[model samples]
Target: MTVSFTETEAFKTFFYAGEIRLLYFLMILMAIDIFTGLAKALKNNKLWSRKSLFGYARKLLIFCIIVLANIIDQILGTHGGILFVTIFFYIANEGLSIIENCAEMGVLVPQEIADKLAVIKNEKGTSVTTEIKEEFTSSHSRDLEGDTAEVKIKIEKD
Candidate 1:
């Protein structure tokens, strides 16, 4: 099915454009969350069916909510804001759950990544500045305030 984009001024600005679709933004956000979770899982060597299923379900729910929001907008007018709010809520929830899942699997999910995720959740659709990106990448191996966890990977001998 084909859908057409309409220009509507809401919140003092145009909400939708001809090129940028809401679905596209949602997909990118969901993909980032899923990949981040998967990376943490792999780092801990605990990637399994359960975690993958959870991530998939979470992504599906986010997309479903977006569709629901569009339906609501059609039914009751002025519901785009509600869609943004729902997206933000799920984003934060899924982000936190990913961290928790990593912790369960013995992955530290470093405070640095957690902090970066928090900032992203708070900003909600804003780009991360260059300095922030550098700090995030550099935070991986450096000790923060000299507090670091020693991750011990065990190899079972055959």
Candidate 2:
């Protein structure tokens, strides 16, 4: 006898919650981040047993947060807004970490790009990743208040 799609564990865990794609993407990012991180650590001879375990635990916690956000969306009778935003935030973070890991392995990232990534990662808040977006928007608006013509000239020069 064939089981219905909804009867499967994968469906219940992911499709039912409308987060299968986001979860899958997050998992992929997590795996890449972990592999890059481990490679960097091994290169530097700093791969502590407890630290690696803690890093895995932290990834698990990130998954739990996405699950919690999905539940929150359900309770509010909304779609996947919360879960999507949460996953997107984590994805950006993991992507930045991967880049940093690659740089640590002597991959030669541009200094300006590395500095900007460092600023984003070092932002302190309950949602540092989210705050980076807000800060960027605000900074852009502030820039607009200064001479738009001058900015245009600067952009043209660049």
Predicted model with the maximum TM-score = 2
lDDT of 2: 0.73
Candidate 2's clash total is: 0
Provide the overall lDDT of each model, using Cα atoms, as 2-decimal numbers: 0.57, 0.73
What lDDT is reached at residue 55 by model 2? 75
- Give per-residue CA lDDT, model 1, range 1-158, as digits (tens): 65434434341133332123444655666676677767866887878775478558756766666667655654566646666666667656655655654554566678887666557543444224323433544355374667868899999999
Going through the candidates in the order shown, the clash numbers are 0, 0
Q: Can you tell me which runs of candidate 2 are displaced by over 4 Å?
A: 1-16, 110-112, 118-158
lDDT per residue (tens digit) for residues 1-158 in model 2? 99978568665455346656666787899999999989988999988776677678879888778777777777676777776788889988888878878876889899997777666564352235435434555455686685645333334553
